[model samples]
Target: MDSSLYALVEDLRGVDAAQVLSHGVSSITVGAAYHRARDVTPHGRTRVTFRQDGIHFPPGDLFDGLRLLPPVQRDADQEPLKALRDQTRELGVPLHGWAVFLHSTTLGLAFPDVTQENCFGDRAAPADLCPSNPDVRAYAVALGRAVARQGMDSVVSESLHFGMFGHGYHHERSFVDLGSAAEFALGLCFCPHCQARLPGAETARTAASRLAASVLDGGPPATELPTVLEDYARSRTPIVTSLAADVADAVAAEGSSLTFLDLTGAVKGYADGRPTGGPAADSAWQIGVDPSAVSDVVPSYAILCYAHDEDRVAEDVAAYRTALGPDTTLRAVLRPGVPDTTSSDHLAAKVTAARKAGANTVDYYSYGLVPLPVLSRIPH
Candidate 1:
């Protein structure tokens, strides 16, 4: 199960929240570090809550020498994680921490140099920190270690890969109709760090610039541009994989495992839960996530099986299972209601499908966001 600090501290309190969240799941993962969002918490103290982009705990010595430090959340003083940790301990339920890395508007705005710059030399996504940057890598490792230090069984790492252009900002406006290929081209980073790290970065940037320009001028989309961009995108695998390895090492040192959260399914299926094209795993490369590479480094993964159909969910999980191999632990994340699910039976079928497809664990999407009745749909 996934939850937030506000849900634990303000909504259900400590023990009550832990007991409520522990109902059908073996472990509970809370958002210890997250990006900015305004979510409607159906059962929360407030009908809606605005979450700031920052860590929920005090950094202390975690980021002592790091240039790209995490911003502390406004409610950090409440020590929600600490309280939940104690409560879960009493309930004998393992507590895990969910940390969003490399996707913070606060840090990106504060240190523009660390953000991703596109082919046009403009900041592509102000909220996305280029993973190729040394400081960003260090910060990610430190953040993982910090979360692990809270006595978590594992740290579920989200947004560890590159951000897409369509979902980078809130209320993002684009009057011009940039096609998927154009958006992909514009989202590529040509910053100094990416240029220094990726091979043939200059050539890729030039191709990307021309492709984006052509699309903007209503010209025919170049067939070769996406292929070039994809080749360039493959070059980012090492950077993200190595970063995951670093974070895994850091978390392991603190006696906790790292679960790499791949949001490809969510990107494809979040709205209506009917994702088209190839399996989510096949498209993961576009976001710098090479499942095989990442799985080799991090033994555990959390795949967002956000689709509604059981067959679709199974297919997505099966692809990830093949990519990750049988040795790695695969956790399938599902939504209990709305966009993805319509009833308890619908949710249960997806869960069973995921497990049969090689998911060792089936975790629900959220605690506060979904209604209590919807949460009850989780297979025990």
Candidate 2:
């Protein structure tokens, strides 16, 4: 620790800085998603899934595609149990205590009601959790506390909302629910809870479309376009982050820092060419997907995920740093094996390029797939 940082840590030995700025730039982040989950069979050691769940959850979500930490290790005495703690203190890496927030896909198999509706108001479409439900919140809070007590320096509150694989892509022209959307529609949550918490979700969704329409054409942003979109962002993003704040608070109250991880994979595609199809609603959709929103929420730490690429990934990191600004903390998550076509040189270059791109911290996704020895060569 730097002299100043040491003094600060000493001064606030037990401070819940999840509510304040986090420490350090020599930061690193690694998730259970980066390793293979343990599996067993009656006859021999068979491959087993350590992921959150399988197909048919979250309306096209696949946690299994990502690595899952072995459930056994989460218990005391497991190698990972000590390793997780040692890694953080030794390396100054904050182990983002991540859980598929309200993502009950796997848990839902036994606890059916755990599913939260999609932004479109359909609960059956995918496995999520009802944020309005006290039960879901309680369970997540319990999980958060569990991780915080495990010597984790920071907590990364992931999946803390009502969304699925195709969040805005499924928006209807005039449709408000998940499955139903009108041509110019920007799909939004008319969910009972959302309506209860923020009555303006519907109106804001409408305004988003109006603004989108103006922006699509040659209409000047000086008109109602910019104002409407800005209102939608102000109304929407903070509410979601506030909800995230609540989750972080649960963990922070136990003396851990809470970081917010947004789904960057989706954002990358959208920036690339994912259609801006309907209404002036990109910002509204961004409310759920952007790193900039992470800063708005007051998370001491922010995680930015990006798909593998030559140019796009670095550019994504650069833009992320600019958007998150200096006050907020940020982490860059690079998905290393999704394509598996990258060369050794490409991987090394990407890692170096990410830090140069201004990522305050760095982490990798999808474990066993990264070729352990090759990954071991990475200088964390």
Candidate 3:
């Protein structure tokens, strides 16, 4: 089950929440480090919770001497994670930590140099930290170590890859109509670190800039770019794979495992859950996530199977299973509520499908986001 500190602390109060979560799930994955959001908690003490972009726990010495440091949330004083940990331990349930890395507007705003700079030399999405930057990599390692040291069985790493152009910003406004291809080109980072690391960076930047400019001048949208774009995307894999390896090593050293969460499935199925594509895994390259390369480094992987259809969920999981191979652990994350699930039976079917298709474990999307009754849809 996926949950949040606010949900455990304010909604069900530590013990009761842990007991409730432990019912139909093998383990509870709580948000230890998260990004900014104002979510409506249907069954929470407060109807809505405004979460700040920061780590929920005190990072004490974890980020010491690092150029980039994580911001601590105000609710850290309540020690929600600690309380949940204690409750879960008594209940004989494993607790995992969910950490959102490389996607923080607070850190980006504080240290603009670490944020991704687009081809036009603009920090369009200040929330996205360039993974190519050494400081960002160090911060990711430190975050994994800190969360692992908190007694978490595994750290579920989210947003550890690059961000897209249309997302990750607050109140973002763009009057110009840029198609998906153009937006993607604009999202490509041309920062100093990326330029130094990415091969043919100058050529790729020029091509991306021209593509965006052509679209801006009322030209029809182009679906594909020059071969340089393909080469540029391929080159980003090594950077992300290396970062995942470092985080996995850090987490392993701290006696915990690392599960890299790929958001490609969520992006494809979050809306209607009727995604029409080859497979979510195949499209992960757009975000700099190479599943096969990451699997070689990280032992476990998690993919969001947000589709309503059991077949769709199975297809997505099967693709990841093929990419990661049989040895690597694969967890399928499903949403048991509207747009993705119609009822308990529907959710159960999806779960069974995912397992049959090679998912080692099945996890629900969230606790507080949906109604209390909706959580019952989770298959035991």
Q: After superposition, how far is residue 218 of candidate 2 from its true place, in Å?
A: 30
Q: Which of candidates 1 and 2 reaches a greater TM-score?
A: 1
Q: For all the candidates, what are their Cα RMSDs to the real structure? A: 2.3, 11.5, 2.2
Question: For candidate 1, lDDT tens digit of each residue in 153-262?
Answer: 89999989887777766768877767788888888888999999987799999988998898778886544546778899888989999999999999999999999999
Off by over 4 Å in 1: 1-17, 220-225
TM-score of each model, paired residue for residue: 0.95, 0.61, 0.95
Tens-place lDDT per residue, model 3, 22-131, is 44776778888888888788877777977788888888898999988889987787777887788778977778888999999999988989989988898868899999
Q: Residues 266-288, candidate 2, lDDT per residue (tens digit)?
A: 44443432222321113334434
**What's the CA error at residue 202 for candidate 3, in Å?**
0.7
Q: What is the number of backbone collisions in each predicted candidate, taken in the order shown?
A: 0, 22, 0
Residue 49 of candidate 3: its Cα lDDT? 78
Clashing pairs in 3: none
